[model samples]
Target: MPRASRLAAQLQDEYQAEVSLEKGRGGVFDVWLNDQLVFSKHSVSRFPEDGEIQSAVNAHLAAN
Candidate 1:
């Protein structure tokens, strides 16, 4: 599966939150929650590790 599809599945299964993926040029992969950036591959120059984004989302959900 594609990265977005994989992450979307994980998020949907775990949190039941709505997820959408947008295609970007030049290898842009970003994850956003509630208009807030949770992960940005471009910024870090690397993809998130396993559970990295999930953890971020979890923290974001907990904080709100």
Candidate 2:
């Protein structure tokens, strides 16, 4: 598993949004947020992917 996938799994336990990684065309990976499109980039760019996920998680936490 990639670092981003590992971290996202951890985040999911504390947040309401669902997280998953989908292997995409040209070996790219996509980060899905609440079943919506969010971050789609190379698997190597995990930090930015995590950051984007964190933003959505934080927003959901804030609203509740």
Candidate 3:
């Protein structure tokens, strides 16, 4: 989960918001912001690329 932690730290720094991570087995990956589902690997059938999650976080922040 080191990569995830690093991403979260970067996101937290860029957005200046809290970031929480939940680790699980069997390919259960997801990202959320402001209680909204931003990305879901299970639903999308793929892992997000570098900067994708950050983009989602940015979009959410802009919307808010």
Q: Which number leads on TM-score?
A: 1
Per-residue lDDT of model 3, residues 15-46, tens digit only = 78788888879987888887799988898899
Q: Across residues 1-64, which tens digit of lDDT does each residue of candidate 1 receive?
A: 2978998999999998888878888989889999999899999999999999999998998999
Highest-lDDT candidate? 1
For all the candidates, what are their Cα RMSDs to the real structure?
Answer: 1.1, 4.3, 1.4
lDDT of 1: 0.90
Candidate 1, clashing residue pairs? none
Q: What is the C-alpha local distance difference test score of candidate 3?
A: 0.85
CA lDDT, candidate 1, residue 60: 91
Clashes of each: 0, 0, 0
RMSD of 1: 1.1
Worst 10 residues of 2 by lDDT: 41-50
Model 1 residue-pair collision total: 0
Q: Which pairs in model 2 have colliding backbones?
A: none
- Evaluated at residue 26, the lDDT of candidate 1 is 91
